[model samples]
Target: MSEQPPSDCFICRKHRGEISIPGGAIYADDLVYVGHAQIREGQTIAYLGYLMVEPKRHVPDLAALTDEEARALMILVTRLSRALKATENAERVYLFVIGENVHHVHIHVVARYAGAPKEYWGARVDEWPAAPRGGTQEMEAICARLRVYLQKESG
Candidate 1:
């Protein structure tokens, strides 16, 4: 492996504290940092509960994960999914591990709400309309809720 990950990598910058983490952490440990996804500018359909489970170290992709990281990834993803369902009324959670856009290994855990359009079901859920892409306050309120549920469950 290289002595250090490329400085320009967006995810690496988050790990380096160069960029502030969005939504903060719902649950985190030495292996992972679980937090809400950063809704991009002009983004609408991605709501507050949309989240990411990111590896703390520089694991470039799924193929690069260590044994410990893999186990923690599964546990964190499952816990986050359950928290979303319980607190956010998500009917199902959509999980996708995509590395093409970012070098760091981050798994997206998205909430699929009840009454979501059939056309947007299955592979098309990403196209479904979001409930409300509220501001940081709204999003943080959600993060706080999820954090509470997670703490109880994890404890």
Candidate 2:
């Protein structure tokens, strides 16, 4: 059998700070980072932090995640999806895990809206236009609202 991957992976490093998302983080737990989607508006990405639900082991694939870990992740994803829809008034939500660069198991919750630009609608994948990055003020507003929503859900 192939040896297990390194315990300290690049994803963990990026989570530490190499890749920072401004106004990006909304919630986090020992096992996940729930934050705004990187490329799309109203999108959210939940990074599965570690393999174990508590012990926080490192693993290369979803099969390494325990059943309970999977279930808890599902619950959190569903809550975030619902919160996004209700808070953002999204038309629909998309969930995916295609880790081409990060090489870690995680989920994306994309809030699809009507009139979303063509660049975001296609499967062929066009380059996202260079729209102005959201400012600190915008991010602060989003973070505040998201925190309220998440706190309410968790209570």
Candidate 3:
């Protein structure tokens, strides 16, 4: 789509630096951006290592991505997943692209650590009672470690 994202697009606003998300920006390039997910309103703590990877453009879904954009996005996703494994000691990295709520092409790069039960596999990994949960300081620390790992393993 040649048209720009609407003025109210949350992802677009974030790309423009209007919205300050937790951990700030982990990585960014001409086509892709990687950052920790924002804490929902009223939530005191967030699931640690929940990252969002999206294109710089305001594409609505994967189908809207140009070839180059798609390539960059997936490559970064792979790298971020690896970073999670290395930095967070995550046993498994889950990738999700549910666009129903935000209408943005954002991928959820979730970390599933060891000792997580089978019932908590997939999207429910964060629901495990013992899952790693943290506040802003914790989020920032984990993001800092991930940033270093990603930079060292630069693509």
**Evaluated with lDDT, which candidate comes out highest?**
3
Shift in Å, residue 91, candidate 3 = 0.1
**What's the ranking of the predictions by TM-score, best on top?**
3, 1, 2
Candidate 2, residue 128: how far the Cα is off, in Å: 7.9
Question: What tens-digit string does per-residue lDDT give for candidate 2 at 7-67?
Answer: 4454554456566654545776666666554434554322111011111335545677887
lDDT of 1: 0.78
TM-score of candidate 3 against the unseen true structure:
0.94
The estimated TM-scores of all candidates read: 0.87, 0.65, 0.94
- The RMSD of every model to the true structure, in order and in angstroms, is 2.6, 6.6, 2.4
lDDT tens digits, residue span 1-155, model 1: 44345677666676556876556777778888877777775764347578888888886788989999999999989988898899989999989887776778889888888888888876566566654456677778888999999889978
The CA lDDT of each predicted structure is 0.78, 0.54, 0.88
Among all windows of 10 consecutive residues in model 2, the one with the lowest summed lDDT is 46-55
For residues 9-126, write the lDDT of model 3, one tens digit per residue.
8888888899888788899888988888877678788989889998988878899999999899889989888899888999999999998778778999999999999999998888
| Candidate 2 residue runs with Cα over 4 Å from true position | 1-10, 14-20, 39-57, 117-136
